[model samples]
Target: MQQQTGIQTNPVAALGRSTISFVNSLGDIFLFFLEGVRLIFSSPKQLTKIIRQMYFIGSKSLFVISLIGIFTGMVLGLQGYYTLVKFGSEGLLGAAVSLTLIRELGPVLTAIMITGRAGSSMAAEIGVMRISDQIDALDVMDINPMAYLVSPRIAASILCFPLLTALFDVIGILGGYLTGVTMLGINSGVYFYRIDTSVVMADVAGGFVKALVFGIIVSTISCYQGFNTHKRTDSVGPESVSNSTTAAVVLSCVLTLVSDYVITSFLL
Candidate 1:
């Protein structure tokens, strides 16, 4: 007779534990978003803070976003041109590049870039504040941490992500133009006409919606991680921030991909 496996887990217990964890995570994010919204509505001078946050998130991220957008479009142009040339349809490269960027690549890559740039930084900043008891200090002063600390960040993310995505799309299309038309001799008329006729307001709107959703997820996850960071000694502070930043980036990416599918299904 075969021996049973050691360390067997109870199926019911495992399922129960997963279900509880999922529910807890869901509730936490809901509360976090709700509190942030409540604070935004109640804040008298929140516009100033939101504006500063926007500059930080939007302006600071602009260069990297632009750089990546152009390169990505050029790469798509090259690959797409070669692929379509096999079928003597190289003129359609612009349409291929535009559709790919607006429908999928733009929002996804922009979110990931923001996650790498600002999301990690946001998490670390919050984590540092938490570890140093700065959050508690705010509490002592009768300030709502959600308003002062979280609201501006979350709002800024929501506002900036779509705009960034839009810029990425435009720059990428231009890059494709540079590579496809200028380099490969694709007719400007055909390229522009195809892109114009093929890409509609609905495509851009769908990309915008994805960007907005990704922004909400990234900001909320990063802030939540920071708000709950564990206290550490001076030597371990860096380690704590590093861990929180990593967690924030990883969670942001995973959620972005998953939500992309969900949103795409509905949009389609």
Candidate 2:
């Protein structure tokens, strides 16, 4: 009877353990953020390292970002022109394209592109280092891993995201110009005039702010996943890396949209 009772309760016990583990993971993330904040203020000498990271993640990512931006803008112009012309407001195409790129598409698309390019590489590298105990070695040598490993990434993301978004905005606008004037036979002068007149400084500023925040979210989440990597007894570090990458992408995308809405509301 006792043996039978034990067997019947095993699943319930497993469920309870799983719940506890999930709660513990949440706690770990909160603590990680706290530690990150502390280290960010305490360590000023890591700026150089952060700049290097920005060069790799942001500067090196320009080509892919430009490609994505150009295509996205071209598509926007093509689709927007058809819809606007249906309403006899084809002249609004330039404003529509610029607003879309500046207010929504620019920051979000650039962030997604960066996440695919840099976020995965960051997670994989850090996870592998964690599994190999190199992080432990740094700790032993009196290096704060949060400062040396994580803070630079956070700083880099904060700086790079805005710059990348700006680049995306330019490339996207140029693509829109090509599509609207060359392909769609829209007046180039009117298109440029509408875009230049309708887009305010506030629109551009807001997009850059969103990019900056998105960068922080992506880098922080990816670093957290990487820093906490543990080699599964049956699995490998690649699994952790992959999971981290997915988390970074999802969280960054969500946060970007959420922040965009909030900022737009406040500005309006």
What is the TM-score of each predicted model, taking all chains together?
A: 0.92, 0.85
Which candidate should be chosen as best, given TM-score against the real structure? 1
Any idea what lDDT model 2 has?
Answer: 0.83
Model 1, 1-268: lDDT tens per residue?
A: 1223322466777788889988997898789988997788776699999999899889999999999999999999999999999999998988999999999999999999999999988999998898788999999999888899899999999999999999999999999999999999999999999998899999999999999999999999989888877733333565777787788899999999999999999999
Q: What TM-score number comes out for model 1?
A: 0.92
C-alpha RMSD (angstroms) for model 2: 3.5
Superposed by TM-score, candidate 1 places the C-alpha of residue 211 at a distance from the truth, in angstroms, of 0.7
- Among all windows of ten consecutive residues in candidate 2, which has the lowest summed lDDT? 231-240
Tens digit per residue, CA lDDT, model 2, 55-116? 98988999999999999889988998899999998888899999999988998888878887
